[model samples]
Each structure stands twice: as structure tokens, then as C-alpha cells.
Target: MSLDKGGKNMGRMKISVAAVFMCTFIISAVPASAGTSGRSVETTLQSDLAGSLNPEGLLLTVGGYRRWISGMNEEYGIPSSYVQSGAMLGVSPAYSHVSAHVEWKPVILAQVRLQYTLFRYFGDFGALLSFPSKDSPFGKDEVDAREGQEEKDWGQRYLLQPTLTAKAGPIIIRNQSDAAYFTYNGAGPYFLEWEYDTLVKDGGWVVSNRTFLLWEAWKGPGKAALLAGTVYEITRSFSADLTRRRIGAVAVWTPAEGDGLFQKPRIYSQVGVNLEDRNRDGEVYFIIGAGFDHDL
Candidate 1:
């Protein structure tokens, strides 16, 4: 029935984009006035982790991310499935992580970005580590980072993101984490240019479930994008009402899967790499991905 009416309109567009991102994060978690946050519209607040994605400041990219959501059904903690959704949202797979900042857009729809996020669950990345700039970049360093102590076994929470993206038609949505629910939400890393991963434990090895949907477009014969989604396994995180479903159908043509590749059949290319995995029992789960966008 037209592919089950497009998975019931992608689960009502993931519950209306999670109810408009939880009603604009509960009205910016309330508390404004510094002249209404120095004239609101400051990318919706929270950014400046030593901002710099390179506009000839050098250091093209310095990104970090660790996404692990579990719940193949937690025995009785709550979340029915997917390693009990990260141990029933205690979330702390290496402190469930994300860190990135990028720069370089002197031209072409112009680019400039500042970012902040510490994942709201327990809260504290110091709002992307506030920086009013002395041309900051964690400069004037003392270097002291002692988070909630997590190497990984369990415990995690965070989804603050920032985003900015430009490229009309073909569609693109950038939100870039103001703690927006995991996995590098939106274009915080300047619509990013590199992402990688690999994980294969051994609960026997691979059961399975997954989902992802993406639509990104960048100009020129040099840039390309598209990742029509599916595969649903984003366990849980401080839920009152959050639901996602797909568990399959992550299509990628990558502009020609080979034999003299490209002339057509792309879904974002630069030697593509997109592999998503999910498991949560016996000890075998996954999220191995890869990305590298280019424009010289």
C-alpha cells in the first residue's frame, strides 16, 4: 500500500520532529533577559567551544563523537528493546559523546559557525565551554576536564546541538545541537566533512535493527548527497513520549556503486561509507559509519 503509506509518513514525521524538538526545548528551558539573551536569534543560544572551523585560521578539522544507544529490550528497567535502550537511559557509554567545531566558508553561500553541547541528560559541557574570545580556542590553557567519570559499561545522557546549513532545493535541515537528541544533530560541524566508526562485539555476533533518513545537497560536481533513511535503534533518553520506527530500509546508491562509478546514482559521495548497526544483549551492538566531504 504504497510502502505502507511511507511507513505511516515516517511515523508521522518522527512524531512531528519530536514535537517540534520538544516544543523548542521547553521554551529554551526557560530563563531569558540579558535584554532577552542579547537580542535572541543568537543561533538559538549556547555556542562557543573555542569556535573555529577554519577560515584560514588553520586546523581544518578537530572532531570527536561516540554514539552508543542500547536497548534490545532491557529485562525490566523500562525500554522494551534496543540493550534495554542504553541500560534504561542511564546512558553513559563513555559518557555518550560528541564534540566538534568547524570553519571555512569565505564564499559559496558563506559559512561561519560556533558550537555548544554537553548532552542534557546529566548536563555539563559548560555550554560548549563558553568562550567570548581572546581569539579563544581553549587558549590560555590550563587544561582540566574531569567529567562524570565514564569509560563505559553504562550511563549516558546528552543531546545539545547547534547547526547552520545553506543550500536550497533538494532540502536540508540544520539544527546543530542545543542538546537535540544525539548523533551530531544537524550541521554543527559546518554541515561536517568527516565522520568515521566501527564496532563489532560478540554476543554471538549480529542480530540486527536500524533506521536513518537524510537529505543533504551541496553545489557543484564536487559535492553530492542523499541518504533516504531506515533502521530504528536509538534506544532511549529521558523520555516522556519519544518514539521512532524503521528497523530497515537505509538505501544508498552513492552515485553508482562501482564499475567506473558516477555519472549518476549518488547519495553523497567522496568514497562513501555508511554502515549502521544495532544490538543490545550478550554484548554485541553497533554504529560503524564514515564520511568525508570535500571542496578545494
Candidate 2:
């Protein structure tokens, strides 16, 4: 199913209008009586360990998540919903003011990541390696029939990510950046004219940055809290000279806090607008997800 130029323009206009309406709705939904005292209980623990030089030994964690996204299709150029489970092994050696972890997500889209935190949580760095199995659901050849080209396998993917966080009172700020490189398995100059308008000879690079501003809306009643936030993201493809920008409103609900087997269960939703996108048909996107962690 392909849309003509005029039809695509109309769809984008409608999505823009819907984005404005959704943003207004999100703003209006914030409780007027929400107080600043709703800060997360973890803040206290963070402060206590801020400058401490005590080593916490090895901490192992297992977690799983499920997420759904609106506007998920090849034409939309967005990722599809999936269920993922993973386990992480970490060590925090406070003597050097650093922490490191390794995580693995197996099957379907197999991935392995190594991450390190430096300067007492002031800076975080990570590298991820991933490749999809034959059972992977992404980039099927059938989805590319309209383009008259067989979609090559995704091949291997490498990513480097860094993040920083800061907090003041009931507000928190975070910024994360990712640089990804992809390798194609077969074919000559794989070109995604619909999405990037460029040819991928052997590999390509895509970089993006996302920033978030969140405020605690309500907290209490046994470690439950509500948070509202806004996120802005910009992405660029070095191989294609393509750029994309997005802005969104988000809300998160933490049901409880504990260090037991399963802890810090959270549910979140977001309404987003593609401020600028040369690819895809829609301007508005919606996502809802939930996840929890297990300590072993």
C-alpha cells in the first residue's frame, strides 16, 4: 500500500493537528494538586552513596519488557512492538568511582552489551552488538515488494551509547546519545530510497540524541509515584545526509519500589510528533510500555 504525494501530505497534516490536540490533552491531565513531595525513594539511596567509597560487590539482575507502538509499518519507518527478556551482571567498585555491567538478550534479536559508569554516575558509556536470527521479524522481503527490491538481511549492528543525568528538587534531566553502525550481509550497494535516499555500500552510520525533562507529579502511599515529562530527539544518518526530529510528552507510573526478586515496576506512555522527517507517512506516534527488574 503506497500513498501518492498528495495523500501523504494530507496524512501528515492530519497527524500534525492530532499531535497538537494530544499535547494539550496531556497538559490538562496533570493533577493541579500534585505536590513536589512525590520524589522517588531511590533519591535518598543515591545521595547516601554519592561520594561513598564502599564496593557493593557483584549485583545480578534479570528483567523483561513488553512494548507497543503506533504507526508501526515499513511505510512508517518505525520499529514494531516486541517482547524482550534479558539478564544483566554488574559490578560496582566504588574505590574507582565506577561501575560496569554486561547484559545479554537472546533469541530472535540476539544482543550483547557492555556498559560502564564513571565518576559516580556522572557519565555512562556502553557498547552493544546485535544481529537478528532467521526468526527475526524486522525487514522482511515481503515488506519491500513495493520497492521492487529484495530486502537484504539486517546483518550485524554495533552501537555506542552514552548518557548523563542530573536532578534538582523534584525535576530530573537526562540526555542519551547513540551512534550505530550497520553492516549488510549480501548485495551490491543496498539502497533504501524510500527511507534514506542513499546507497549503503557495505556499512553506514546513524547517530541520534534524546533529551528528557521530568517532574515528579505525585508520590506516596508505599513508594508509588507519578512522573510527567517531555522528550526531544534528533537523529542523523551520516551515510545518507538525512535528518529526523521528534518531540513528545510522556508520563510514567511507578507502582512500587523494592529490592526483592521483582522490583520497581513501571508503566509509561508517550505521545510524540515528528517535527521533521523525510521518510515515513505519519507525523504522530504513540507508545505504551511496562517493565520490571529482578534481583538475584
Candidate 3:
């Protein structure tokens, strides 16, 4: 491994350590609700740590990025210069076997996603639906427009994304497609609303394969430590181009106890390297995020 590879590995380790510290410090500093036994609370907390499998809780997380890029692939369809400093706000509320998730990148992009677990075999298999911002910053026909230029009059877009997910043991896999329709700005006849366009027009559908394995590294009742091995992704879009491949690790810490803001909190840190693409060299992006989990 080169120096960059070594540094990236260290970054992943740091995130794991930080998660452990966060779980310990928060649980110790916050008080639990009165009258509920510790064992009872821990049992309830266990469900929240099961990721989307449990499927019943409120999750809120906010974080800022040194580099913020829109679209599925880093800068595939968007201008590289437009990727700038930004903050992301995400909320996911799960009820029964269904969950609704929303993520906003302010003016950059926004997406609303719905996930439903149709059944559970060895593990859980589900369907996911997403509506994302599809309008180009500039008019679609303006091939010469510069990046970040706000369009005074342009067509708006509505996109629907559907995905299939399979989770078994520690492994998870997802397959998805993005379908979109466009309507001219402020147009009334609304005839355009009836027709749709595919962003990946050249190809029938954009296909991506994502896989990851998560394991419990350590646990003590309400508090637990986790480590993950991820293929992160190797995206093959409709354009017949490979976006970028990532292979990395993630560390997480979840305390089954509540802080004032949330009854259960999860802290995660991930470090991954983008494999060198024809257009850009490989780089490492380290992300650390914390979120509260509350049962409704």
C-alpha cells in the first residue's frame, strides 16, 4: 500500500474509535426516563440498532462536507466546479414496515425516498422508491451555459426511482432505476406532464451494484461497536461509462440509552477511496456523522 492507502486505513480506524467514545460519553452524560427498568430499555434499544430492518423510528442527521456534488456519480452529469462546500440534512421516519426518508442539500439537490419491506425470508427483502431533483441548473438545451448559472426560464422535472433490496445475514444488495418526466416552466396545458424522459437515454436503464457486510465487533447490552466491509460501489450508468469504484471500511457506535434529544443515538465514521477514473484521479473522502433514533 502507498502512503495514501495507509492514511486512509488510519482514517477508518479513527472513526471507529470516535464512535466508541461518542457512545460512551453520551450515554454516561444523559439520564434515562424514569420508572423503566434498564433491561426493558435495552431491549427496546436493540431494535433501533438493526438499521432499516427494525423499520420503526425517527432518525435525524446533519453534516457538512468539504466537497459536495450532486447526481448519483460524483461529477458524472454535473460540472465538477459546482461541487462546493455544503451541508446535508436528512430525516427518516419508519413506521411498521414502511419508512419515509428525505434529504436536502439546499439549492443543490433534494430527494424523498420511501422504503417498504415486502417480506422477510432468511433476512429482509424490500422495495425502495425515490423522487429526486431532476431539473438541470441551466436549460437542458443550453449546451454552452456555465456551471451554477440559475436558469430564468427552463423546464422542470419530476423523477421517480424504484429499487429492489435484499438483505441476508451481514450482506445487503440493491438494484435501482431512475425514470423522469419534464414540464416547461410555468406551462399550463400540462401536456408535457404526461410524457417522460430518461436521463440515461442512451441506455435503457442505469444499473449499479452495491454490496456491504456489517458485523458487530463488540457489544455490552445497550452499547455496541460495529465494523463494516464495503464494496461501496462500482457504478455502470446508462452512458456505458464506469463512474467510479470504491472499496472501504466503516465503523459505528450505537448507545441504546437516550440523550435529551433522542432515546437512542448512533455515531458512524466511514473512509473510502474512489478508484482512479479516466477523468479523475483516486481520492479519499472521510465522513463522520451522528444521528438520533427515537421510536414513535
Candidate 4:
């Protein structure tokens, strides 16, 4: 994470937020465990690609994702299923959850922006933005405000994402550093680490190879669990190895994943490079997936 390098207090905010949301979910979800005490595992794979002919002009992009989550209700000894379409909407330009943004484009490839998002499930809202920096990679930078539910945190949160991107012929390279902070009742300067994505694209073949790095800080809900043993172990173990870094690639065959069920889906795959508490790690966590992309 970029921490305080950008003057954004994001790193401090994420910590406090994590504590709050972890407790909230445990309190709310655990009680329903009656007749549901079991264990669960979930995994998801998705793909997306977008480009601007001008690179510095208005951008159009679309992508699709599919996720499968299943867990056991430790108390009731039953299984549970979870799926999120919000992940799809977040990256969708037309249907983005962003309520509004105040923006500035100082140069063709540089922009400054203030963005806000509302999470219906958590009843939380976020205020975020991005700024054009002289030292930025490709001259791009972003800052954001997220609510408790945005990242499953406790309450209000702030984030700073400093990004650098380079273009070499048909390949594009990008690196981003992310940090966040969380505050509740004006009580914290607590810091928490977060997520990032690295991508390498080949314009010539309309293909891309990418990786996603994500993690969770252990604190507030570290000890809370709905199940006594295995279920709790599953959650704790997963959370402890909270750092999730995935590497994958995709190849676009036609134009998109298809218009309907009769059409073909886009192909994508990913392997977990570093997994927490794993003896047979790296590449052991692999997923093959299909999705769609459209220009809007």
C-alpha cells in the first residue's frame, strides 16, 4: 500500500473499518446459525479488457464475472451459498455504483476526480477521488472514500491508490499501490492494507495476462465464529492467509463473450501464486473461467 506518501490518510482508515465490519457480520450472521452449523468454501473467476484508441480520451469498457461461494452453517449443520453481481457492476461503466463524480482533465491522459459510492447491502456510503500527479505512472492517481460495507469494514473508510502504467508497443504494464484507513466516532487513525491488480496486455493478439493481489488484516473479528471448530477454522485460516494474489491470462476469440446463452463465452484462467498456511501453495489454487466484454 502507498501509505502516507500521497498525503491521503487511507492507510490509517482501513484498520478501524476492518474491525467494525468483521464484528458486524459475525453478530448479524452468527445468530442464524441455528440448524446451520457447518463449513463452506467458495471460489470465483472473472475477466475484463478495455482500451481507448486515443489512450488519453474517453474510455469505454465492459467485462463479466461469475463467483461461487458455499459454506456450512456450523450451528445447524447445513450448507449456505453466496453470490455477488455487485462485483460485475463495480467495473461496469454504464451501471457503475458511483453516484456522482466531480472531475478535471488537465491533460489528454491525466485526470483528477472526486467519486462517491453507496452500498445498499451495508447501508454505507463512500467518498473517493483521484488526482493527476506529476510523478504518477502514466501520470495517473486515485483516492477514494468507502463505507463499512464497501470492503466489509466497520464504518467510514478512506483509500489512496497510486498507480503507474507503461506502454511498450503492443504490451502495457501497470502497477498500483493501495492503502486504507478506518474511523468510527472519530476514534481512529488505524491503518489497514488492501488490494491491487497487475496487468500485462498484448494489443496484437487481443489477449492479456493479469494478477490480483488482495489481503485482510486480522483484528476485530479474528476470534468470532459461527461454528465451533471446522467452520471457524475455515474462516480463520482463510482470513489469516488473507493475502490473496492470483495470476492469470485471457484470450479474446471473437468480439465478446456472446450476446446470449447460445453464444460462446470468453475464456480466462488464474492460479494462486502465494496462499496463506499452505503446504502445497502457488498454482495449487487454480481456476478456469469464461466471461464477456462489450464496448459501451
Candidate 5:
């Protein structure tokens, strides 16, 4: 296969089983406590959506994440949610410092995302067109915004993530970091990820640019669920041209009703680590984050 063609399908197949795994998380939030009932209608919408089918509403991932941006510039945020390890080498582990809660209404899915990478704040608001499981592009030819070159590295990252979902699985296409260099210049690096899953619990496999096989336990009760993944991570220092390698793991915790998007009191938190990569080198990371899910 050609280099360009090969890079598109690098890992995570067409729909990155991992992405599909997180995409379907359903949150069953507890009913709002006494008081705070007569607030605004907007508040009510946020609240109803909170305990709805996607606990991802108002996601705050905190722990730690590191990225070698350019040759000499490196960013490591210990308590931020939107951690950007800068697509290190091949695989870069990230702790969600800031995440958005996804709300799906029959046909359209809306999202509100917030992220803090180090000191930089990134927020997102958008919508996605949903598809049936029989038409998704699980493994196809597309560039990886993170692993490959065309991906927008730095600066504003805004785009609609058009996904294909089918009985075979799903595929996602988008940019990498919100870097202006690639985004403004139209360098692209648009990547594709794919995965195949089933209604059966723990019956799916995920593929992405940096990681190999990943699986999930589909059945759950709490808004909080456990997701695990294995990866070969790559770290590149933009200024130094220094490179680092490590074996990594990804854990995502999504809860709801804390910040109460509907104006109810709801809190959110997330923590994760790439254990082996840092090893005893102290290159490890920890991300701690929290936030509110609001709507108008």
C-alpha cells in the first residue's frame, strides 16, 4: 500500500472500537434533589439531558498528560481535562482534562466540550448526524489528525465529526490538535479510526493510530463506567526534536448531575495515567479536572 493510504488506516480500524465504546455511554443520573426545581426552562433541559442516555454530558477528566509540541516546546498538564500529548510519535496517552457531555435527540446529537491543556483553555460546541450500525466506515482510507501529518496540530480546532456506523462497526474523521499551523494552512492530516462491536457485553475490538486491540464491557448501571485500552505511545518535543516512547493505558470516567446542566447541582471528575511509559523515569502524568454542563 502507498504511504498515504497506509497512514489513513494506521490503527483503530475504520471506527476505532474505542471511540464507539465511549460514544455510546448512557448516563442514568439521579433525580435532582429537593429545592432547585423552579429554575429556568433552559436549566431543566440541561438537567433532563444530564441523566439521559449520555453521561458524557459535562465531562471533566483530570490526572495528567504530556506532549512534545514542537522541537523545544513541551506541554504537560497535571490537573487539566483536555490533555494534548501532541500525537507523540505514534501513540500518545491523554487524560481528559475537559470533556463535553453528548446529548442525542433521536436523530441529531449535540455536544458541549471544554478542555484545559496545561494553561490553555479549549471549548467546543457542535452537532453530529447519527447513522445506523449498518452503514459506518469501520476501517477505511483516511488520515489521522493525530498520528499523521495532515492533522491540524495547533490553534483553533473546529469541525464537524461526520461518522459512519454500520453492522460492521464505525469510523470517525477529524483533525488532531487545534493547532493553527495545519488548520489555517489547510495541511489537513484528517485521520480515520474504525471498530466493530455488538450488543453483547464486552464484544467489541477497537483500532486507532497508536494502539492495538481494545475491548469494552457494554452493560452498566451507574453513569460512571470503566473503559480500558493498551497502546504504544510516542512523544516528540517540537523544539528539541527529542522523542520518547512508552506503553500506555487509557481510562475514561464519565458522570452526570454534578454541575447540573439544567441548573441542578452536578459535579464532574476524571483521572487517568499512562503507567509504563513514564515507568521510574518520573515522566508520568496525572490529570484532575471538574466542570459544569450547561445549556441555553
Candidate 6:
């Protein structure tokens, strides 16, 4: 996901204030998590929102997410899920505007995700686009604070996401990896490097991997099912030399077959802890959300 660029004084102040208010209210009103990126949490939620498999054709999803981490002041909440809609033709394309509020940080990211199946019921290749520096929201002080003393303005960002899935009896295993590239609004130009251990002077890359192991806990008579799973996530930022790791347990509930207003509904909850992190003070986190999709 991508955030919009920074604006002038008033605009920046307004966004900052709104973000603080939302974070405060959410903390008092709900639980919290550590310094996990809003995009990461949204990715997990979206995965669960798919229920058993990815939906086809036009689809819409609505839900809210909340997380809290122990040991730090950071907390994130989406009291209401942002605009999430997508469609799958031969190539699936989707868009989302995610508004995340933290104690001292507020970010709004707009992203388009395109995916094409590489093989039937196995794997796929995907790309994430946040284009036009003016429209994309990365490296903005109002949205994300600098991790170091140096100041820089980030421009467009892109990511290549590849996925793999396997199933055996009642268990399913899935893995998704992301390699991200960034552009900056400065003089220094950086070339793409496969070496994630090396730092770049200007733009850089972030790599992440997420894996899930799910078990079919229960099944209803119709199209309803309950799944329990464990998720492992690791993210590394080459520019900032930041690394985050988390492990959690999740449960998802899918409703029975129906053509009602809810369509294909999914309710999910997760609770996890940071196994290793140097960014945020928190250690544990919790998430609960519900969403439904409709085919066009």
C-alpha cells in the first residue's frame, strides 16, 4: 500500500491532528498492537476476507481492524475499513485506500494490486502500484516520521508479490513474498540491487514474507466453514535497517451459501506477539474484523 505525499503547513497540521485524535480515541475504545505497518495488517485481513479462495469478477469488501502492541505507545486502528474493491478478469486487479491511525502517526495509503494466476490452484504473480509522486503517499513527514536524522521525500513505489499454495487433507499452507522498490524526489539516483543487506544512498528496497498454516476446524452442511490458522510474518527495510517479525493465531468463519445482502461473508480474529522487533515498544497484538464480498 502507498500513502500520499506531504502537503503545506495547514494540510499537514490537519492530518497530524486528525491522526492523533483517531489514535487516542481508538486506544481508549479498543486494544492495540506494536509498530506493524497498516499495509501488513490489511494484507492479513484481506487474506482471511477471501474465505476459502479468491473471489472472481467484481468484488467489494468492508470491515474494521484494531491492533495494540505491548511496551510501546504505538497503536493502530481502522474504525471503519477504507474503500476496498477489485475485479478479476484473466488478470485480477484491485484497489484500496487504507486509513490507519497511530498514537503519533497517521497514514493514508492508496494502492492498486494486479494478479495473474501462474498455475491452476497453486500459485500466482502479483504487482502493487503506487504511482505519480503527487498521488502516492510515501516518505511524507505528516504520514510517516523519519526513522533517522536524515530527511528525504519519497516518490513512487512498487512491489512484486509472488504467492504459492499447497494443500494436504484438511490443512493448507500458503506463502507470499514481497520485494519492494522505492523512488525519491532527490538528486541521488539508486539502481536496483538484489542485495537486501546493502544500503542505498537514495531510494531503497524492503522485502517481506508471510506464511500461513490453516486447518479446517469445522464444516457446516452448506457452504459454511471454520478455519484456524497460524501466521508468521517478517519484514526488512534496507534503507532504514529495520526488521520486524511476528507470529499469531487466527480464526476465520465463512457463512453458508446465500444470495442475501451479506453475500459471501467472513468474520475473523487474530492475536499475536512480536518475536523480534527494533522499531516499536509493543510485544503483543490483537485484531478482529468482518467483511463480505459480492460478485458483479
Cα lDDT over the full model 3: 0.31
Where does candidate 6 have its weakest 10-residue lDDT segment? 117-126
TM-score attained by model 3: 0.39
lDDT of 1 by residue, 250-275 (tens): 33323312222122222211111222
For model 5, the run of ten residues with the poorest summed lDDT: 192-201
lDDT of 6 at 33: 29
Clashing residue pairs in all predictions, respectively, total 47, 0, 1, 35, 79, 11
Give the C-alpha miss distance for residue 93 in model 6, angstroms: 24
Q: Order the candidates by lDDT, highest first.
A: 2, 6, 3, 4, 5, 1
- Per-prediction TM-score to the true structure, in the order listed: 0.19, 0.50, 0.39, 0.29, 0.27, 0.47
- Sorting all predicted structures by TM-score, with the top scorer first, yields 2, 6, 3, 4, 5, 1
lDDT of each: 0.22, 0.39, 0.31, 0.25, 0.23, 0.38
Q: Per-residue CA lDDT of candidate 2, range 1-296, in tens?
A: 12343222111111111112122222212332332222111111110111000100111122222222222223212222222222222222211122333433232112233433222210111011122222221122222223323332333335555455555667766666656665654443433321121223347876777777889788654436688889997777676566768788888776756776445455556667778765332456665444453322
User: In model 4, which runs have C-alpha deviations exceeding 4 angstroms?
Assistant: 1-115, 120-157, 183-267, 275-283, 286-296
Choose the strongest candidate by lDDT: 2
lDDT tens string, model 4, 72-103? Answer: 43542323343323132232111122222233
Any runs in candidate 3 off by more than 4 Å, and if so which?
Answer: 1-148, 152-205, 239-242, 276-279
**After best superposition, candidate 4 residue 158: deviation in angstroms?**
3.6
In angstroms, give how far residue 223 of model 6 lies from its true place: 3.7
Top TM-score hit: 2
RMSD of each: 23.6, 18.1, 18.4, 21.8, 19.4, 17.9
Model 5 lDDT per residue over 55-130, tens place: 1112222222232121110121111112122110111111111222222212112222223221111111110111
lDDT of 3 at 30: 24
- Those runs of model 6 whose alpha carbons end farther than 4 Å from true positions after fitting are 1-155, 184-202
CA displacement after TM-score superposition, residue 32 of candidate 4 (Å): 51
N/CA/C clash count, model 5: 79
